[model samples]
Target: MRISRCVRWPAVVVAGALAATACGSFEGSTTSGSGSADNLTVSLQFTPRANYSLETDDAFVLSQVGCLETLVKYDAEAGALVPLLATEWVQTEPTAWDFTLRDGVKFQDGTDLTAAAVVASLQYLLQADAPPRAFTPKLITSVEALNDSTVRVRTPEPSALVPFRLASINTGILAPAAYTGTGIDPLSHCTGPYTPVAQTPAQSMTLEGNATYWGGNVPLKSVTARFIPEGATRATQVRTGESQIALGLPASTVPELEGDARIKVSSAFTPRTTGLYFNQSRAPFDNPDVRKAVQAAVDVESITSSVFGGQAHPAIGPFAPTEAWAPDSPPVNRNPDAARRLLTAAGYAPGQLKLTLLAYTERPEFADLAAVIQANLAEIGIDVSVQVSDYSAIEPSLLDGAYDLALLSRNHLTDIADPLGFLTADYSCGGGFNISQYCDPAIDAQLSAANTENDPQRRNAIYADVASQLQADAVTTFIAHEQTTAARLETIESFVDDPLARYAVTPDLTVSNS
Candidate 1:
């Protein structure tokens, strides 16, 4: 799970009554508003990492809080695209698609959602200083307003997944007024069911239901989302009735919450993986044999069992095993002997090489995982020093390739529902978020082919091949596939357990007072 906050709490208590005071205190605490059916309160794991920039991953906050709406939404269950703001879409040409906007849709700012607005919103994203990874100028060439209710999108190459690209939260549509010379102001310039009326930077955001929402009357009058990083605190908030909904609960807190009568715990296999990435741009890691040796040193099964409490399964590739694109290979067994041999082949003598393993505290499990990995590497005669810090502090160094190794939890489908976008943006030569700082022409070729392949079967086959290549290259050690878990008050109805971590608050959601 992607979580944030600079503070690191004491080790989480596994199964018992949590001392409410031990979870630490919030500066500005608010009631859950459970006394009234018209109000609701939610606790989220991540705070705004980029000050709620629509161009960055912060867009997900807008999406989950119901303050933003996209042209299309991905229905993971149906394995198909569904209309949201746009009523229907058709491919006019291999590289061009025409979308028909829903009639009478209005932004929360009381402005009409016209084709011009859609064009402007998309243009803003495309022309951003840091374009969204899901769809950039590299893939999308232009968006033109054909008429008052129609728009045409053209891509640089023949694309079959334009609809899927539009479904990404990063591609969410906003009113033209939201854009400014300095930055975006999404207070009332969105078309979603809720409108942000108040915020406290990294603390919390309060949203009021949009009366003119095109989806019909929203069930709640107001909603407050608190940004709490500690998983135990999030659980305590839900248990104490301070919040009705708590998302991103740590696995260790599940057993305790499951016993609560008022709270209902929900979990699902997600397309997220925790990985140990090597900065290939740096020293020893520049050698493929060294990377392979490190991969062989780590025990994935032990980490999954001891650190995650069995909430996660050993990952064989970047994609989750439950995902259709995942390869059917068995998990790699731990082999310290093989690791030592590889190190010898790579010209590294026992105890000759020393490296740093960076980890962030937001995920909670990273600390434990880091310790286990450090011990495992020691057995292979590798000296590893573990460094734990907040993700915010570690991000710059990770991106700059200043770190030797790092632990990262990534969602393969966050950019788009398909793994194609993830593969391209994370592993390709010019990938924007290539933390590994590793590149290969063969992998790039496979990703390029998958992007243009319209046939689902062929595209999936290409993805499997790329996965095999990545494993063979030992570009990164795929640790484990995570299971997303959340706890909510039983009184909250129509709660969506979205596997993609999108659309937490919606028009159908309701809170019962009795």
Candidate 2:
């Protein structure tokens, strides 16, 4: 059974509550079935941001709890789009594609999952100011339900990779009741293996196996997921048996926990990049010389080794070495003298330029990276004042062009399967998430062409060129490419970190209490 309730509170209160709470035994599994262990408690790095139906930040959490489903799934290893809700699809027209969904699936609300429901979910996501922002809706022209199991999506132009966009959590298909006149209602109107029983925003959530779940019997009966931002605290929780699984463990603790017999650490290279976003719309930063100066000032080696405790790799480009398109280039060398010369050329003298550096504390490494960057820039005569806050608080200033520089950890695979979506959003003019406000007509034209190119090899070549141009322009200082590390108990069987940062606890997961 699914129960939906709204829990509204100030962000301050949520933070305080999390800080005060320690790991403790919660409710047990409610589902009646044979499994190794009955119930499980998991810890996450970020809480679900408010207005989930509209916001994209917490969709991964929603999907992990089995409360949401996307039309397709991208198999990163295979480099292909596999079926999820969408069983098969074919391009009916140059601008349109028709999808055949798996039938007999029902939402937690008992509503028959239909093609119209898919259209409604997609429509709500396309609306401006929606909670979970998506670039997919911008490319789409219209959606129509051809039959009970078939839905057709038409783009403004011919798009060969439309299915990839549908795989994003931002486009998760929800029941009609989930969307209200105001926006998306935070309810468990999803079609998945489990349904949400109770949800407390930024606090905790409870999910139970859907007995009528279309998928086979869920391994674990129930799951209670908590949002614990502090990595050390999460490490403590998993170590103390307060939680069986913990996500977003700090690198500093990995050594300590890896030696322990009770704990196991699982990590993988995520399509996530840590970088400095230079606000090109602002003064000093607007000048290419200044941008290059700042890029050259930082020592990425220290960031990857000292700051991350050697858990991360120095970024060669937007795509990490894990990605096939990552360029075979030498590491960026720190040249303080050249940086000073460029600053002088850009009409800035030593100690003359002062700028604000913005960052958030969601990922603890970012705050540390910001401090290192602050120190690195200071050596080159640039005065930088760092402000640390929640991501929600910092994002507005970034989008409004109020910030001079932003230390951010962005996922390249968040939107579409290819890196082009990430490049276009960060480098192209009029990009929805262009907080840096960097734009180049040549870069934009090349990326626009790459978006529709069907051939994978040809598309990769285009992306390689775009990466080169962005690197030469020094649009932003690429810091490190991150690998997601999680702390898990030894009892948990078949544990793996999803490269996409979703699907942590799937039907494959099992637990052995003995």
Candidate 3:
């Protein structure tokens, strides 16, 4: 992994900085926006790890930040599907789909975007060494190049959301050079509005607009992005003019940043959900009664209102309220007494049961959420110790069953339009992200049925049934689905938050000169 140092700026003069920048009343020169036609700097909440192609989350985010392009994209504002590398697509048969590649599109390496390249990129995602295993939809059986501009997709079962699946970051088409003997070349072989000129793995990256891009008018010429994992640091970058745009500001910082006239805070409700995953392979949690007890002990309203400042909606199930297939289920009610009773009946001694709760500090609120759970579980006679660290460090413990419970945030519909992709990835027997090591044959059957079902109504009904079953079984306890937030200079006019985090850095965004 190649690590690079991030450039730092001097302390911000926040006393009257916003007033001076907004009103243009200061006499002396003040550092503000780029004040140019096509140059900007953004601060990202998450950083890219080494081997970008192997990591699905890194690919999903960087693809939007101008590094790579997906075959299709979702327009959150329009609530419709938009074209990227693939211009048009259709379902020729129940189990087969066809896509026509956009002409004249060139990769960063000057290679043409062809059907064979798309197939190779998709194939790379299924490699044994892929970081995010099971990123692609499980229904896909094979990908074949029909012609220079056309591609065919085959699924083991009839899939209605094949186009949506292709639009995922895991399917981002790459140049042939990226497919090396053993791994993918991270900084090369990508096609997007912007191309990486320099990158520091997990720290910062510099990008220049692609002249050969098929997309219209690449307004932004250059972008320097610093990955500040700390939320407070990210907000600081926005206020200090070090970063023109800051993505993923913590909810706690929104009120303070909103006070600045020059800093604009924006948010959009997304399909992402934060929840507590129980390791069923571990003792006590292996019992369904104990899992239900922990679920009953949690207070979702308190966490949403007090911890999040009411910026989020309590999760009813895996799918958010914005999802079309979300079941009209009520949020879990807090029942400490019932939780204690269940714990005692499960042959656990009072005040002697102990467990370790693991959580990462990336989201800023995760630590606080863990504390809330700690306090809530204490009442039910479960002694809990919280361990907070980075996700990379905690992931090993999660996978190996070193922790009794894990606090995880997941986007249920980011990869696929339907929630099945996330369900199968996080819950099934072969789930790649299954931290809890949970496997239920009944739930697996329901997920398979939903994936193969062609009828929309029937598919959704099956998904609803699976959601109910998961909740009833207490596979994981849903906390809340938060609204994605970003902070930028008030001069940013065309900044729009895409729910899936794609289509964020486009040609239309511009900063006002006035």
CA lDDT of each prediction against the hidden true structure:
0.82, 0.75, 0.74
Model 2, 216: alpha-carbon shift in Å? 1.4
User: Which residue pairs overlap in candidate 3's backbone?
Assistant: none
Q: What local lDDT does model 1 show for residue 118?
A: 94
- Residues 1-514, model 3: lDDT tens digits: 1111211111111111111211111122222335475778777777665456544566755665777777777555444557778877877777787888889988878888899888877776755354344344455678889999988888877766677677677667778787666455645468877876666556776777888777766777787777778988888888888888887778888887888888888777777888999988868889999999999999999999988778788888887654656777888899999999889889887788888888887788888999999999999999999998888788778877778888988887665656777888788898877787889898888888877666666777777778878788888999998777888887777877666666556667776665
Which scores better on lDDT, 1 or 3? 1
**After best superposition, candidate 1 residue 249: deviation in angstroms?**
1.1
Number of clashes recorded per candidate:
0, 5, 0
lDDT of 1 by residue, 1-514 (tens): 2221111111111111101110111134343445588989998877776756678867888899999999888776555667889878877887898888999999988999999999999998899888999878998999999999998999999887787788899989988877765666777888999988877778887888999999888888899998887878988998898899988878788888888877888877777899999999978999999988988889999889888988889989787655667777777788999999999999999999999999987787888899999999999999999999878889899878899999999988789878888899889999989989978898898888888876777888788888878887889999998877888988988886677888789888999876
Write one digit per residue (lDDT tens) for candidate 2, span 183-289.
45545578887777766656777887777777778877788777777778888887777888888777887887787787878776788888898888879888999
Cα-based lDDT at residue 219, candidate 2: 79
Candidate 3's C-alpha runs over 4 A off are: 1-35, 131-138, 186-188
Q: Which candidate ranks first by TM-score, i.e. highest? A: 1
Model 3 residue 366 lDDT?
89
- lDDT over C-alpha atoms for residue 104 of model 1: 91
Q: What is the alpha-carbon lDDT of model 1 when measured against the actual structure? A: 0.82
How should the candidates be ordered by TM-score, best one leading? 1, 2, 3
